[model samples]
Target: MRLTSAFSILCLSAALGTAFAASPVHTSGHAVTLDLISGQGTANGGLNFNGGFKGSKTFTVPLGSVVTVNFQNMGTLAHSFVIRKGGTVPTDADATDAAFPAAYAPMKVEAGLKTGMTQKVTFKANKAGAYYIVCGVPGHAMGGQYIHLVISKTARTASFN
Candidate 1:
């Protein structure tokens, strides 16, 4: 009787495992891409807040789809990409107004470049909304080294302009 009970438990566990594995996991369909470049660092190959993007002015990606950003540093200094919720992205308005907090905002995922280094990052767009991507390397965001992203249930294939 004990042997039979053990076998039944094993079967139940296996069935539960299969069911769990079959369930779909929820993810944001949003995707992101960034071109990492120096943002006003040391002119002599040092880490400062002076260098910025040089090649691509803006990057357009699909909404609600998984985005993989391939960033590379084409300058002589190191650079980093810092993404944030819409509220945190730098704006022309008053600093006080931009300080308002919102829930479920995107946070920073650092991607750096060391003068020809490349980094890749992939994320799902779980929410149908818009967010800002920028280089938090001090003055880069203010100098227009960042762009807004719109995420939706259906993916978009046009430029984000």
Candidate 2:
């Protein structure tokens, strides 16, 4: 009985780990996982994130949460997904500055993944403020492919609204 119980516990733990690994947005004590899609629609001339454009959708998470974004490009054109420092529509310099090098997936700033490519990006929400998930391609963000990312000290969980 003891052996069986131990084996069962080990199996359960492994299963739970795998489940969290595959989840789109899974949050535990201090970690958050998200699946971010870029250019998912025709909105804003195909410049959009998660089907929302121009900060229409705001993703909120607790400050200090370890964030992992699994990014996928769904647009007809190549697109790069990146986290900029602010929520404003960026100038050419800001768009390709690669401010958060750890948060841009697939390549460096100004580099892009072709359509239908996927990559993972990880970072920490160390501060509470408004940020942006923008296209690293120059002029793309100004064309309206961006969304708001709010790292909130008061937010108890992760969500978008």
- What TM-score does each of the candidates earn? 0.46, 0.77
Segments in model 1 whose C-alpha atoms lie over 4 Å from true places: 1-60, 88-111, 158-161
lDDT of 2 by residue, 1-161 (tens): 99999979976875696587543455677888777888787888788887788789878889999998888989898788667778457643333454454777665546678889888878888878888877877788778788888889988767766
Report the number of the highest-lDDT candidate: 2
Tell me, by TM-score, which candidate is best: 2
- Against the reference, the lDDT scores of all candidates come to 0.44, 0.76
Give me the overall lDDT of model 1: 0.44
